[model samples]
Target: MSHPMHDVLGRWKAAFDGHRPGAMAELFTEDALFQGFGPAVVAGQDAVRAYYEAVPDDRRAEVTVLHTYTVGERVAGGFADVTFSDPTGWEAKVHMSLVLRRDDNGWRILQYHVSRVAAGG
Candidate 1:
């Protein structure tokens, strides 16, 4: 079955793989909080765009949706396991989670975070 979250993630994946930083930012809310692979967390769409812009153009992301949820009719969110790969075959795996809120513009990400998925403890 298809979910709204799937559609959002699908568009995100397309933008990411295409290295369209501006396009990716459009999916996020104006004040969205973001934490990519960078050290400090940033806020807002401009920061989000800058973060993606810094990523290598050849790097592509494959996301596996691990879970999803809805908070009433105005909010929804999900967790995903993502593998980012480059032309040289180098890859980085991480766990990502995002929350979205419905507004006049439709569902836009309110928060987006990424963290390293630890290896065997």
Candidate 2:
């Protein structure tokens, strides 16, 4: 079966690519958790909004999925490279796992954990 999670991920990519920070927040649930900014675990829709807003206006995120495999309900794992447009040109290849739940609004990410890939990983 095709995982609907792919669509959510695509929307997320499009949101960031177009510099629509607000759209990015829609991908998460009301109390979703994000680990995008270092060790800080940002929680809640409003907090996520604030986090996205803090990013430079011209900056954007690009995600290239390396792999994806679904587990039990609301769980999946994938590898991807995320690059941000910044002065230092920061880039990260991370192994990510997402926990999603199907609600009245369809699939939404509830928790996301990402770890930086090792050198040559």
The best candidate by lDDT is 1
Compute each candidate's TM-score over C-alphas. 0.94, 0.75
Q: Give the poorly placed runs of model 2, Cα more than 4 Å off.
A: 66-79, 86-90, 118-121
lDDT of each: 0.91, 0.72
In candidate 1, which residue pairs clash?
none
lDDT of 1 by residue, 6-121 (tens): 87899999999999999999999999999888889899999999989999999999999999999998999999999999989998899999998889988889999999876751
Among the numbered candidates, top TM-score falls to 1
Q: Which ranges of candidate 1 are over 4 A from the true structure? A: none
